[model samples]
Target: MSKLIIPLAIGAALLGAPAIPLPSGAGGGALQARELPAYLQCVPYAREVSGVRIFGDAHTWWSQASSRYERGNRPRVGAVMAFRPHRKMKLGHVAAVSKVIDSRTVLLDHANWSPINGRRGQIERDVKAIDVSPGNDWSEVRVWYAPLQALGKTRWPVHGFIYGDGAPAARPRVVSPPTHVAVTRAPSRQFASAFDAIRGGASPAGYRQAKPLPPQRGYRQAKPLVPQQQESQRKSQGQRTGAQARDPIAQVLARYD
Candidate 1:
């Protein structure tokens, strides 16, 4: 019986080149690449670290947290802003309050916003965002874009803010003392414009007609608001607090009040 001996060889040359051992999951290619940074998405990440108890996408947070947490349209540091759907964001977006610069400007920390390294689901920290709403209501805003390093043009509408158990920054807001003036009309000082007091320090009964007050940054009024919008606000307020629903943001506006 003649037995033929067969030689078995296993080496880097088997793959046509020196086989550089790779991690098990590394995909085979002429150019090996490392895995991208693994970062969390917006909604889940916000919920996880926000200390707020709410669920669903960013758009649903405000309505869901209305009863349990302090919800309002004003931005306070540490609140989660629930963006509304618009031309750009169809599923909506959520960002945590990192800093309140002023009444109409804030810095937000969010994930999956700016595309980095040509990848989605990235994190943007301490990005500047500004309120562009006509009412200065914190409803419409523009967020900073990392690639451009500038504020984006896409206007984003927001449902409002959800406040949790978080401390605010050292931002000092001059919340004009709650005025006994008609609730319909914000205090003259609170709504000062570019014009000044008439001839002297006397403001005409009609501020619009009087010399306007020098315009102050982060200070604006929801003037020229249509009757329909006013009526809608009132009606909506009535629905939220029941008999006391006449004021919806009582808990929220308390800071400013």
Candidate 2:
């Protein structure tokens, strides 16, 4: 069983939002209130995608004395958690949540979450969120290299799963394929090359100009030709010659005889 950390001071520091009072007589062994700011900052993204509003301290398990795992056991949709080693820096870590899409698999979000200059605030993304876990919360979550920046922008499909008893078993139906309707798509190698060329500012005169088109006529009269001219042209034709050579009267006489 993973040990849970429930720090009390962090719960006291929450400003506008009222703290969630833990259930009385709820097996109070140890409680470590989680920090509000970092967890609260992730709430908007969670709410937008998962439809659940996270309030109060984010609950996590202490896998070891120095290390804490934010998401474990009771995995819920849109819940974000951190994974820190037992005796390491605060920011060199991974963050993700349980995506309840189905009964079989779940999605994860993690990135190059190393601390910049030993500060808790500095973090960046070499981040990807594409891990799948079985339908049990206790099962270890597998991290995927695929990261999702926007909810619907990948060629691959997005899905999630739930674990444990009485959990819903239906898979999330895909409403539509991921679309790119943004003014500019995410930067690619071609865009980078074009940007580099423009920055170099080497203008050549090899550019071509467009050509002009001819004016159009509103209407035109059909040309009239003699019927004899058309007949004369077909006079030497093989099909017409073969048809003319067949004797219709001889065929009728042969049939009668």
- Clashing residue pairs in all predictions, respectively, total 6, 12
Task: Assess candidate 1 and give its TM-score to the true structure.
Answer: 0.50
* Model 1 alpha-carbon drift over 4 Å, by segment: 1-39, 166-257
lDDT for each residue of candidate 1 in 72-115, tens digit (9 for 90 to 100): 77887778988987776777888998888777678898988999
Runs in model 2 deviating more than 4 A are 1-40, 60-138, 144-167, 171-257
Q: How well is each residue in 147-234 modelled by candidate 2, as lDDT tens digits?
A: 3222222223122221222243333453565677666767887667766766787432443445776556885655665898778777
- Each prediction's RMSD to truth: 17.1, 27.7
Candidate 1: the clashing residue pairs are 193-213, 195-211, 195-212, 195-213, 196-211, 196-212
Q: Which ten residues in a row have the lowest lDDT in candidate 2?
A: 57-66
Positional deviation of residue 106's Cα in model 1 after best superposition, in angstroms: 0.4
